[model samples]
Target chain A: MDYKQLQGRLRSNILKMHHGAGSGHIGCSLSCIDIMAAILKFKNEADTFILSKGHAATALYTILNETGAIPDEDLGTFYKNATTLPAHPAPLKYAAIPFATGSLGHGLPLATGIAKANKLKGNDKISFVLMSDGETNEGTSWEAAHFAVANKLDNLIAFVDCNGLQGFGNTADILGNTASPKLWEAMGFEVVECDGHDIEALMQAWKKLAANKNGKPKMVVASTVKGKGIKEMEDKMEWHYLPMTDAQYTAAKQEIRAGYGLEND
Target chain B: MRKHFSEYIERNLADREDFVFITGDLGYNALEGVAKKMGPRFINAGVAEQNMIGVAAGMASQGFQVLCYSIAPFVVYRCLEQMRNDVCFHNLPVYIAGNGGGYGYGIMGSSHHAIEDIATLSGLPNMQCYIPGFVEDMRATMDEMFARRRPAYLRLGLGKNLPADMQLVTGGTQTVLTPEARLTILSQGPVTNNLIAALAKSDKQNSIDVFTLNTMPFVTLPAALATSIATTKNILVIEEHISIGGLGSSLALLVNEAGLPLDKFISLHAEGYPNGLYGSQAYHQQVSGLGEENILRVINSYF
Candidate 1:
C-alpha cells in the first residue's frame, strides 16, 4: 500500500469531518492519524484497539470509514446532536470501538484488563491502546502501568502520541516529562521511540514489540507535531481548538495534496 | 456480609468459568480462598480503584462476569467517572462490591464514609444499586446481579441474621411486622436491623409497620410495600445514606407517581459529621439519629 497516499486521504477526510462539524480536536486528531493507520494495517481480527484519548474520535472514525467498518453516511454524522460519532468515542457505537473512552486515563487500565483476560482465557490476542501525552498526567495511567507490569501483560501494546501540546499549552511546560519513554521504561514497559507521522517507523516499532515474548507490556512513544501535515497548523496550540475557516480549509487541502504529491487528486 | 460475599464467589466458581474477581487491595482474610481457587483469574489491583474499575469494564467487554471489590468510598467515590462512562454506559456485566456502606467505617472520619454512594451510583444509566439488609440476603443479591448481567453496585455492611420467623419478600423487600399499621417505616440496608430491634421491644409495634428495601433505583414500588404505603397514609423513610436521591427520594417519587396519598412523610438519614467527632458505628448512628432508640421515638411519634 502507498502509505503516503493513504496518509493524505486520511488527512483530507479528517479535515473534511472537522470542517463539516464546525468543532472537533482537529490538531489532536491529526497527530495520531498515522499511528492509527499503522495499527489498522498490522492488527489481526483477534486484536482489539481502544482509543483512550477519545477527543480524537474523528481520527478513529475516519480510519474506520476507510476500512468500511462504518458506512460513509454514518461518518457524515460526526459531532452532530445525538449522533453515534460524538466528540468522544462511545462503546459499541461502531463495531471496532469496544469501550466508551473520551475521558483521559481510562484506556490503559482497560487495555491491561483485556490483555489479562485474554491471557487467562489462553487466547493470543494483543490489546492495543492509543493515548495522548497529556492523558498520562492522570493517576490511573500510572496505576495501570504498574498493574500491566506486575501482571506481566506481554500481550498489551500502548501508543502514546507525543504531540507536545495539550488543551492548555505545551505538555512539557504544563506537566514536565509526563509521557517520556524513560518514565514508561521505569514503570517496567519495554519502550520504543519513533517518528509518529512516519507510518513505516510506527510499523517497524509495532513489529519489534509484537515479536517480543518478554512478559512486559510494550509502549511506542511516537514523537509527533500536534497539527501535523498542514504547514500553518503543525505544532500550533491554536489548531487544537480551532476549526478551519473556508479559506484555511482550501489552503490546508492544497498543502496536503502538495505534501503527499497528490496534486492530481 | 464480606464473609458471605466471599463464600458466594468461592461456591459459584466451580460452575462459572467466566467469573473474574478484582479487588482494590481489600479483603484481607475473607477473599484469600477466592484468590487460591481462581488463581490468575483473581486480581489484586493494588490500591488503584480507578484502574480497577476500568479493568473490570474491559474484562466485561470480553464476555467475562467481572466483579471489582473494595471499601465503599474507595470503590464508589474514587472512580465514579469510570463507573459511569466505562461500566454503566456500556451496560457491562461488571459488579462493584463495596464493603462498608454509609457510616460502616465509623471512627475513620468523613473520608471513609459512603453517605452518598446510593444516590451517585443509582443516578447513572444502566446501573443498579443493591444494599443487602441481612447476611442471608448477600447470596440472593449476588444471584440477581449475575442473572441480570449488567452494571451493579453491591453495598456491603453490618447486617443482622434474619430471625427464623421473618421471611424476605420477593426482590429482597421484607415486611418485618404490622403489615397494615397506620404508619409504615420504610428502611434500607442494615439500618433496618436497628429498626427491627427497636420495633421488637416496643409496646406499640402493632401501630407501625416496617418494610426493608434492598434494591435501589426500583422501576416501581414493590407490590406489598406499595400496598402498605397506600393503606398507611403516614410514612417514615430511614436509611444510612443521605436523604437526597436515596431510598427516601426514590420512594417519594414512586409514591407520588402511584398516586398513593400521604398525610405525613419524614426522612431520617445520615447527618454526616454532625459534631466532627469520630466514634464507633453505633455512636455515629446515634449522632445521626439512626439508632434503635431514635427509630422507636420516630415510630412512636406517628401514633
Candidate 2:
C-alpha cells in the first residue's frame, strides 16, 4: 500500500465514520493514521496495540479496517448502541486490540502490568501503546512509566501523538510541559522525537528501538497537527469533533482525494 | 493481644505470588525489607493513589491478589472513583490497607485521622472492611483471609494499645467479654479496648456487657447471647468510625429492618472531617473522644 495513498483513504474514512457516529475526537483521529498503519506493517510482533487516547478511536478502527482486521462494511457501526465500536474503543471488538483504554492515563499502567506479566510468564510479545499528549498529565502515566523503567520492560514501547491540543485547550497552557522528557529520562528510559505525519520516520524509530535489548522502556514523541491531511481543519480545535455537514463532507472528501493524487484514481 | 500484623505478613513472604502489595512513599523502612523479598511481587507505585488503585485493578485482572496501601484520605478519598469503577465494579479482590486510622496520627492533626473511613468505605457494594480491635484480630485476619477472601481493606491503629499476643484474636469470632447485661457496648478497632477499660474502671462492668467485633462487613454479625431488647430496653453502639455508616449505623439498619424493638439505642460515634492537616493526637481525641467514657455518659443519659 502506498504510504500517502493509504493515509488519504484512512483520513476520509475517519471523517465519515466520526460524522456518521456523531462522536469522537475527529481531528486527532485523522492525524495519527500513518503511525498506526506503519506499526502494523513494520513491527512484526504478535501485533499488539492499545489506543491510550480512547477518544480518537475512529483512527484506530480505520487502520484496523485497512489491515483487514475488520470488514469495511462494519465501519458504519462505529458508535451505534448495538455496534461493537462504541464511543470508546472496546478491545473485545477486535482481537488485535489487547486492552481497552479511555480513562486518561490508564493505558500505560495496564500495559505495564501486562508487560510485566508477560515477562514473568516468559512471553516476548511487544506491547505498543499509542497515547496522546493530553494523557501525560495523569499521575498514573508517570507511575506506570516508573514501574516500566524499574522492572526493565523492554518488551513495551509507548508512542505519544503530541498533537498539543486537548479538550480544554493547549496542553502547555493547561499544564506546563517543560519537564516531561526530563522526568522520564531521570526514571531511566530512552526518548525519541519524530514527525507523526512522517510514516517512514515513525517506522524507522520503532525499528531502532526494537533492536536495543539494553532493558529500558522507550518513548517516541511524535509532533502532529490535530487535523493532519485535512487542510481546512488543520490545528483548528473547533474541528476537534464538530460534525461535518453532508456538503462539507463532500468537499472535505474531494480535497482529501485531490491532496493525495487520487482525484481520478 | 497486641498483634503486630507486620510480623505475620513478614513471615509469609512467598504468599505474594497471589498477593501484590502497592504502597505510597510511607512504610519505607517498615515494609521495604520484607517487600523487596517478594522480588517481582512488590511495587512502590509512588505517591499516586488514583494510579495505584488502577494498577492494582490491572494486577487483579491478571490473577494477582492486589493490595493498594496508603494513608486513609489518600487511598479512600483521592481515589474513590478508581476504587468504585475499577476495583468494586469488577468485584475483584484488592485489599486497601491504610495507616493512621482514627486518632492514630492524632498528633498529626485532623488531616491524618481516618474517622470517616468506615462511613465512606462500607457504603460501597461488596466492600468488606475490618477495624481490628486488637493485634490478635489483625494476626488472625491476615492469616485466615489469604486462604479465604482475597480482597479487603484493613485500618491499622498507631500500635499504641495492640493486643499483647494472639489470645484475643480468634478465627473470625466476635470475642465476648460480658454476657446478659442491661447495656451492650458494641465496638471494634483500637478504640474498642479503650471502651472496655472505661467499663472496668466504672465497676458497672458487671451491668454493662462488652463485645469486641473483629469480623467485618457486618455480614458475620455475631449471634451473641441476645438480651431481649424488650427486657433490657437498651443497646449502645460505639466505634472509632463516624456514626453514619460505621458500626452503629450498620447495627441500627439491621436492628430496625429486623424490627428488634429496643426501648432505647444510642450511637456514640464521631463527627466532622478527620482529615486535619494539623499534627496532634489530641485533635482526634477532641473530635472523636478516646473511648466509651463519652458513650457511657450518653447511655446513662438515656436511662
Candidate 3:
C-alpha cells in the first residue's frame, strides 16, 4: 500500500474536519494518523480498536472513512452539534468506536477488559488501543498495564503516540520521558519502538508485536512529531488546541499534496 | 449485605456464564466463595477503582454482566468520570456494588465516606441507584438490576431484616411500616433501621407512616406513596447521605412536580464531619442526627 499517499490523504481530511468544525487537537491527531492507518490494516472483522487518547477522534474518523467503514456524509458532520462524529468518539455512534472516550487513561483499561473478555470466551480476537504519551500521566493507564500483564493478555496491543508535546508542555519535561521503552518493559509489555510517521516502520513494529505468542500485552512506543504533515504546526504545542484558519488550511492541504506530488489534484 | 451478595453470585454462577465479578482488592473476607466459584471471572483489579470501572465497562460491552465491587467512596467517587463516560454513557449492564454506603465506613475518616454518592451516580443518564434497606432485599435488588441489564449502582451497608409484623408495600417504594397517621416518614438504606427502631419505642408511632426506598432516580412517584405523601401533608425524608441529591432532594422534586400538598417538609441527612472527629458508625450517625433517639425525637416533634 502507498502509505505516504494514504497519510497525505488522511492528514488532508483531518485538516478539513478540524477546519470545518473550528475544532483543535490537530497536532495530536496528525501525530497519530499514521499509527492508526497502519494498525487498521491488521484489524480483522472480529478484532476491536479503542482510541484511548480520544482527542484524536478526527484522525480515527478520517481513517475509518478511508477504509469505507465511515460514510463521507458522516465525516462532513464532524464536531457539529449532535453529530455522530463528535470532538470525541461517541460509544456505538459508529460501529467501529467501542467506547465514548475523551478522558485520558480510560482506553487501555477498557481495551484490556475487552481482551480479557475475549480470552475468557476462548476467542483469538485481538484488542488494539492507541493512547497519547501525555495520557500515561494518569495512574489508570499504569494500573491497566499491570492488569493486562497479570492476566497475560497476549492478544492486546497498545500504541502510545509519543509525539512528546501535550496540551501544557512536552511530555518529557512534564512526566520526564513517558515513552521510555524500559517503562513499558518494566510493566511486562513486549515493547516495540518505531518512527511513528513512517507507515512501513509502524507496520513492521505492529507485525513484530502481533507475531509474539508470549503471554504479555504488546506496546509500540511510536516516536512521532506533533502536527507531522503541516510544516507550520509541526512539533508545536499550540497546534494541539489551535483550529486552522482558512489560509492555514489551504497551505496545509497544499503542503501535504505537494509532498506526495499530487498538488494538481 | 456483602455475604448476601456473595451467596447470590455463587447461586447464580452455575447458570449465568455472563456474570463477571471484579473487586478493587476489597471483599477480604466476604468474597471468598464467589472468587472460588468464578475462578478467572472473578478479577481482583487491585485497588485501582478507575481501571476497575473501565474494565467493567469493557467487559459489559461484550455481552457480559459485570459487577464491580469496592467501598462506596472508592468505587463511586474515584471513578465518577469513568462511570459517567465508559459505563453510563453507553448504558452498559455493569453493576457497581459500593459497600459502606454513607457513614457505613465510620471511624475510617471522611475519605472512606460516600455522602454524595447517590447524587453523583443518580445524576448520570441511563444509570440507576439501588440502596437495599434489608438483607432480604439484596436478592430482589440484584435480580432487578440484572433484569434491567443497564448501568446500576448497589449501595451496600449494614443489613437489617424487616420485622415479621411489618409489611412491605413493594414496587418502587417499600413501605416497611405504615400506621394510620397524618405524618409520613420516608427513608433510605439501613438508616431506615434507626427510624424503624425509633418508631417502635415512640408513643406517637401510631400517628406516623414509614416508607423506605430501595431504588433511586425514580421514573415517577408510585401512586400509593404519592397518595400517602399528598394526604399526610407532613413529610420527613431521612437518609444516610448528604442533604443534596439524596432521597430527600429526589422526593421533594417528585412531590412538587406531582403538586402534592406539603404542610411541612423536613429532611435529615448526613451532616458530615462538623466536629472533625471519627468514631464508630453509631457515633457518626448520632452526630448526623441519624441515630435511633434522634429519629424518635424528629418523629415526635412532628406530632
Q: How much lDDT does each candidate structure score? A: 0.88, 0.70, 0.86
Assess every candidate by TM-score.
0.97, 0.80, 0.97
Chain B TM per candidate, please?
0.96, 0.85, 0.95
RMSD of 2: 4.7
> Which run of 10 residues does model 1 chain B get worst, by summed lDDT?
B171-180
Which residue pairs collide in model 3, if any?
none
Model 2: per-residue lDDT, tens digit, A138-229?
Answer: 87788788878888988788888888888778888988772266667778878888888888889889878867978998888888898887
DockQ of each: 0.81, 0.29, 0.85
Looking at candidate 1, what is the lDDT of residue B200?
A: 85
CA lDDT of A198 in candidate 1?
92
Which prediction has the highest TM-score against the true structure? 1
B1-303 per-residue lDDT for model 1 (tens digits): 988888888998524779999999988899989899987788899988999998888898888999999999989998999999889999999989999998998888788889999988998999999998888776777788889999999999988897554577766755555655888878889988888888887887766767777888866887778778878899999899898889888888999999999999999899888788889888888998999999889888887
Looking at model 2 chain B, report the run of 10 residues with the lowest lDDT sum. B164-173
User: Which residue ranges in model 3 land beyond 4 Å of their true spot?
Assistant: B170-180
Order of candidates by TM-score, top first? 1, 3, 2
Chain A TM-score across all models, in listed order: 0.97, 0.93, 0.97
Each candidate's interface RMSD, rounded to one decimal?
Answer: 0.9, 3.0, 0.8
Per-residue lDDT of model 2, residues B200-283, tens digit only: 557465566556665566743344524434345578776677776677777777777666678778776666555534545544
Clash counts for all predictions: 0, 25, 0
